[model samples]
Target: MDDDDDLTLNLFTPAIKKNVGKSLENVIWGNRQQRIKARKLLKLTARAKPTKTPTLSESQSDVYTEKSEIANNKKRKIADVSLDFDNNKRRNDGSGNVSSTPTKKLKDSLHFSSLFNSNPEIPTIDVKPVECIKEEVFSSDSFESLSLDTYMLRNLRETMKFNQMTHVQEQAIPPILNGSDALVKSQTGSGKTLAYAIPIIHALQAVRPKICRGDGVFAIVILPTRELALQSYEVFRALVKPYQWIVPGCTIGGEKRKAEKARVRKGINVLLGTPGRLADHVIHTKSLHLFKLRYLIIDEADRLFEMGFEKDVKLIIDCIKEKTLKKQTVLLSATLTNGVERLAGMSLESPVRIDVSQDETTCAVTPKIDLHINTRDNSNECSAFSVPDKLKQLFVVTPCKLRLVSLVALIADKCVLAFKKSKMIVFLSTQDSVEFLHKLFSNLFKENDSVSCMNALLSDQQQDIRKSKCLVTFYKLHGNMDQKDRTLTFTKFSTCKNGILLCTDIAARGLHLNNIQWIVQYTTPGDAKEYIHRVGRTARAGAQGNSLLFLMPSETEYVKTLSNMKINMKEIMMRNVLHNLLLLFEKLPKILENDRRPPRTYEEAATTLQIYIEKVVNDEPEMQEVAKKAFQSFVRCYSTYPKHLKSIFHIKYLHLGHLAKSFGLRDAPGGFSAGKNPIQSKKKHFYKQHPCLEIHNPKEYVKKPLSSFYEFASGH
Candidate 1:
């Protein structure tokens, strides 16, 4: 072997074995060429590079250091904009572990672009000059009573049935009526709306002599959700009926914007809605004015500030404050958290802080220091819990897979007491969960007609619900649905005699749906505060309601955390069988074929949303413009977009590669194919061995796969 061959001979010995008589150098060169070609091929094919074990730590670190941002699009200057309407400051408020620091230029560009893209055909919205008429103030004359006129007093007593004033009403109403800014922290469902509502109505009545416009709003009440907005609007609607001059208008997302504008043009005395939709009008349209805004109520004030509405709400407050110096600001929330004290200082002038929450203080000392109890005060008075006194809260400890079966069983059991009006609100943590649970329930109850009482009310007739005469109703509500569809779903669920609403936390706050017999926490809330709100959905206004919280062995700790709120959660003794649950799901093959079919893959849901968007824009051309305003939120609803959805959705991210990585590749593979049922292939029946019984428990309850954890309830 020559000098070059001798040195390189060992390298090619493995390679030379395959091709005998080949020179060592030649063999080494050929293998190197093949490797180069293979690398080129891989790059061309766009395959992920295989990561190797670290020869040194720095070499391994380099693999992860270069983060590709696929969101930045050079094609458009209006790219990667997190618009004012969509950007909730809380998400990017630097409170999270990751970077929420959005680009300043992107936010500005997005806001302007959306505003600029609004229909030019919409008339130059002009805010009618609101005249603040001065009269004998109610506070000065008689602050002792509600300080409302005789007619108003009668309405408050007779219509609202307010016999004795709530502590929140007593403390908050006086300062507000006297033209003072008030920061109120009251319990949920404590008539906080009335404390502000009664005073605002009274103040408006004082200005009755002034010329009023039917097309503009005088007072704007901002809430976190459309459901809450609707509830507050109802309070105003019913209160203002006595004064025919007072017109209340609701302007929230999920309702027709054009229709809302028309209502504004018709002149509304009070505008109750979410920050985003209201800001959409204030900035993008001139259809409304705050020139005479006497009362500005920020209900769920902490939520408005915390859940990323700080920018929108602050923008609103700025717009109103600029127009009217005398606007009385009222901020009401359960907790004045997330720097809300700072907000109160900024917006409210010498505001009276009303904290009527009667919960007992927990000891900060260690358990052994005080037996984990506060005994020093020696007061026997049990503090009021955040969960209402009327609410019967139950914790159903079960596996996630068993939750659906448990829900069905509970419904069957409770249907009798509901008296033909079994209204349930099943709260899930994610939109995907909401959609899945809705499909599962719909499948189980396909034969039971009129599930969606909304067919007659909704613009879409695809469900054909109007024709059905049966009672059991089912509906789904989440952020993804078209606003119009969402509104219809909310209305249908609100009005239905026996309806089931499968929803996310989106429907948790301020939704005052009557006869809500149960609030099923299909998925445990993220924390104790969320649990409070979920359970708060029922037992509202002195009505009896039940809340079922599903818990896994790991999740039982959350129940322990509810100690701060003193929530009485009774653990339910589940009397269920697996066979009964499987049996309840009758004729799945036929139902799967008949009801179009449940989403067999992640792509299916994304594709469905894409089609939904297309159909909405196609059916109504004007909606295309509105859709642009909400473009970011729309894409974010389904973050993992496949090629079909990605192309159809057309999202512009700030860093394309980072977004791609954060979400996922567009061409990800599907789940099991539609035709393949992983279960037994027996097509005729669910099971021949276990003859279907009237038994409601799960069919395979006895099949103890995770049976060890099933005993978790005993420990609790």
Candidate 2:
């Protein structure tokens, strides 16, 4: 080597040169000796030990210094390596000792957690209902005590069977009747509709000249959804039956614009409509006059803003204000929100804030009819949010694979074979999920002789088992459906004696269905406030109701989060849900019995039902497509949860394969094709850009004659 190369080589330890060109055995031995020497040097450096040095010649001292410098450089490099090793050990195991086994790091890899417990004895904790310290406002006054016209009073007592006033009605009606702009906040199902509706009718009745069809618009009531508009229209229709001269007309988005224009030309005494449709009339329909408008009532005001109807509402308000400045405005909401406050500021003038939910004043009215039996303080009294007092809230922690069977069992046990007529609303996260489950359950509960045929093939002992003849009627409602279909579905579900309505969040707010017995959240809502609105559908008007929430083991943290929001729920074991399902199957042989042997155990029964559902999906190509779409939509919805709830509903922790099983798919869609990962697909973008627009034939878009307008309008 050159002298320069030799100088570079001296910088490293001499152990490197000694190991080079040696036998393999010698090299290994050399490395061991080098490590020993490094360790000894470390000890000497750390201890700073004094070394005896005898007097030597000048050349001898120079060579010794060079050798000592090389030794120090080697010791520093070895010390760095040792310190790194110790740091890694502590980082891996959180201790000085190294871990026995190396942990396999998984980055974006699939794995499943073992959450299913075979033990049948699952413990449950009972949640006690929290009582509010505020005094309850129990109004015993009847409707007669209010200064209402005789015909209105008669309609209230005899026609509507509403003899007594609810606490909200007792407090809100008086202020609204006094012609003061009012902001009202009460619990859901607290007679809020009638609170404003009655006052509007009463004021119109006192007009000197009796109102007629061509009297122009007297009052305009804006609602958040078309279904709510229709519902309010019905209430107005029923209330105005005594005064036939006072006409009530509805103009929502689904109906024909020409027909609504004609109604406006002829004149509507009371108009009820959704914000968008009403705003369209204000802009386009010249005959729709607000010159004589006396009242403007916005029901579900918070929902109005939440649904992105703020601009439409403001447009209608500005137009109404231009027409008349002396009108009374009533803003009503089940919950008070900042958006509602902003809306009130824009519309209401010196508004009387009558919040029966928080008001503690006692009414000095005489007791005529005791209506306390029909009312309870279950609204917002127990918590910051309000739910029906009579609602029995329950939650079940289930494994992803067992989610489908658990829901099936729960519905069969609670709705199908129950002694009384049952009405249930099953809320899903996505529209595709609602559509797929509706089809699956409809086929499973078809009114046919398949169950009887299977029972006939059984032994006489098994044949003797009694069967439930009650048929299950399934209805679906989602935003994607045509307005007419949605309206018809809502109407049919409302009137059906025993039925199940599979729906998305579109039906979560403001539509009051009669006698809703159960609310089943098949998918946990992304927002906690949504849970409050969903469960509020039941236990309405002092009637007893139940709600069941399906949750995975990973989502148990949601229960605690809800508890902090003052929403109490009792835990129901998965074992008990399965047991109830088995009992129902035993009673009703028609469900999932297709000439097959009976299940002997709960596990077997669950497996059989799962296989049966999977067959139903796979056997039909259309259903298989629906299943895939639903699965993809569900995952997309799950991943887009709000930031605060990301910890509880993380997409990384979800088992895609097991989640697909709940949708009746043998494997997840992403696993089926390497090139097409459904989770990362562009379908979500397509839906977002064209939410209400669907691809169809060119002929369908062409305008039709007036005769075929109904078919076109209904999307038939």
Residue 390, model 1: lDDT of: 68
Every model: Cα RMSD to truth: 24.0, 19.1
User: Number of the top candidate by lDDT?
Assistant: 2
Q: Which ten residues in a row have the lowest lDDT in candidate 1?
A: 707-716
TM-score of each: 0.55, 0.72
lDDT of each: 0.53, 0.69
Q: For residue 713, what is the lDDT in candidate 2?
A: 15
lDDT of 1 at 409: 55
Tens-digit lDDT track of model 2 for 217-273: 989998877787889899999999888889999988878889889988987989898
